[model samples]
Target: MDAQPDPVGEPAGSLDPRAELSEFLRTRRARLKPEDVGLPDFGRHRRVPGLRREELSQLAGVSVAYYTRLEQGNGRNVSAEVLDSIARALRLTDAEHAHLTHLAKPKLKKKQSGACAQQQQPVRPALRGLLDTMDSVPAYVSGWRTEILAWNRMAAAVFGDWGELPPQERNWARLVFLRPDYRDLFIDWEQKAIDIVCMLRMNAGRCSDDPRLASLVGELSVKSEDFRRLWATHDVKEKSFGVKRLHHPLVGDLSLQYESFRLTDGTEQALVTYHAEAGSQSEESLRLLASWGTDASRAGSSVRRTA
Candidate 1:
């Protein structure tokens, strides 16, 4: 009843999702402040930004080897009590904690046997209205898989072409690695790609058993070596609100601030919007983008999504 290698054993790409989950939980623990978790420091020379795996093991009252195995996704049949202890030690937020538990033991075996694990279907109409209301910032809604479900005119202008792609190919991960335009569009494409890999790692833990999620990974594995390597490393991170550099053909380059608002009623679908400070260069760039979008809007160039 536990996660195991299939007959002939699935390739690392197939079982790599578990490795991803483990790495994320382990990495998150490694990056925590001892003070945040009520742990006393020994005044040792700190060489790393986060807590050591040994320290995490001690805090969680588990053997270092055992914890290491968990992090590598080698050990299964973990107890809920231990998972709780690790969660507490990590000082994870409620959502993070729930996600951690889900990673430790997928819901498919029991919890998802009959219960409704899915959130509200698709993006809410009210949310779409809100996206339309935004004056200039590009706004869009995307599910956990980075399936871009909806977007406004400004968003349509920026990543507008993506909406024209098939749903399976429209995934942010795919676009970051597979699309030729990604390199030209992102000023810091490498960092952005790394960030997407990390974020996708976090999602992999929460949705490892989801068929759609599996399909996305399978498709990416077959098509993108970048995605394949990063997914194999099993890294995960949380990057919600931040500044990003973008290169637009019409507006040149600009630094934009963005915020990700998660909808509780949806399936962790997020609304991300980017804006420039009132007097920032990005503001001018955004105006140019808006102007371009207005022109596209007038042309009635509605991009139809693929898949």
Candidate 2:
């Protein structure tokens, strides 16, 4: 099948939703097998990997030509029912299902001038206060571009002092790919790195015109071979609740659960909070770290008073 061309009159760096949707569908289809989906294999030689287009179409209860059109990026005004059927046939996770829907129906692009005028807004005062009050949990607010907008003292204590870095250097993707220390912090560094890039890819799909995000992706692609390889895979994922295993310089190995809450206000910022299970060794480590952070703050204040 011929590949779909880029949308006419679109800029070189702008995203093509149709192309994205096609690639996403193709890749997902490539990963499945006939046996995996409870289909019989007749030992027939196949030219391509995974289930054939006809097989997928049969499983999805759609005509092969119709399914092929969707996979080829020619299906316009695709109904939700069809998408849901396709999603079930592919056995997609919740995150993957949502991503498929986003690709199928991307938001209408805002004018370039309006988008360019947009800037990262400040975290609300109440939200800042909320972070301050969460002394026991390490929490931070991140912009849609994964920019570290605001972090609490506990967050600083756990994840280095992001405030010390320049605004451009405070991004999650930059920290993972550029900083050796941050890369070493995670136990599963390779997987963690891939997830970071995947999340960035998802962001790119949603806000392709964001100059800052585009610049960051370009910089990383140029600097890090790992980032370049992963970005080429076209993997996309949204950050959700998960367990993180990390080795901090001060604290030892810690296994923490993180939950991300979306802010109701217009901004797409999310409040990410990390906590250890009560009575677990990780909880003890967190307590020690919190105490150390508190003492360090007190000492700094005392020195300022003495001066």
Candidate 3:
């Protein structure tokens, strides 16, 4: 009748859902203004940046003490009705509401035998072939943890030679936080870094027990001040479609739109493809980059055969 020990070196602790909920609520509350939420300004100087606890409780039709407890992470059995009312008072978007619910009720961690027990599934040959066929676009496959599982030649040309890195170093978040070259590559580096952290925070909720993810987060937190600051904001975001601006060393500035699709093959993988608008300067730059990549690949192959 004793509790079992957690898997080896998997960290001595798991994520604290209540703490996450508290931080998220605080940040969201701080971002709202009295006038923005249809509350009257009494012309009195305010100490806080956003609505007061009493003001929020009044708007949500809840008692100040109860809302205070919720904000303090002590509302153990918050009902759906109360949550909905709070969401409405906060004027949360659909994504924000879902994220609030997740923070309030995080998924339970799964028991794993060991750190290496959960091996990454191999990318399907068909998917790899599909990537290769996208000669004009940059594409790659990523796992649930945002690690690059597979990438095409165009992806390498556009995003640097990912194949040169070890598998553990090929992660998107890792490249964003740990590599100066990647930071220099993006024109909107600050926004991109924040978005990457938000996506990682969202994934951390679902995979709190994954050692690889935990390690990545810890490393970033310790190494990058920006990562630490953004991570504390408790933002959550899903990576879907978005526009990115990159300043490739070989091709100058380019604007690319990316789409992400979940794979059907049950491995919880996603295929992300990046493309430029037709007949645009970015499209021409992409073509030039792809040609350079192709020539470089062939030269490397020839050298390997000579060796």
Clashes of each: 5, 0, 0
Candidate 1 collision pairs: 30-51, 165-306, 166-306, 166-307, 167-306
**What is the C-alpha lDDT profile of model 2 across 30-114, one tens digit per residue?**
8999999999999999999998999999999999989988888764678889999999999887767766776676543332123
TM-score of each: 0.71, 0.83, 0.84
How high is the lDDT of residue 136 in model 3? 85
- Worst 10-residue lDDT window for candidate 1 reads 1-10
lDDT of each: 0.67, 0.75, 0.75
On TM-score, the stronger of 2 and 3 is: 3
| Clashing residue pairs for model 3 | none
Model 1, span 1-307: residue lDDT tens: 0111111113232334465556667667766877877778888888876787888999999999888888887536788888888888887766566666667676443353221234315666788789888869888877766666777888766654544455556567777887766666788888888778767656666656555556667777788887787766555566688888876655567788889887665356778888889988889877877777666433322421210
Q: TM-score of the candidate numbered 1?
A: 0.71
The best-first sequence of candidates by TM-score reads: 3, 2, 1
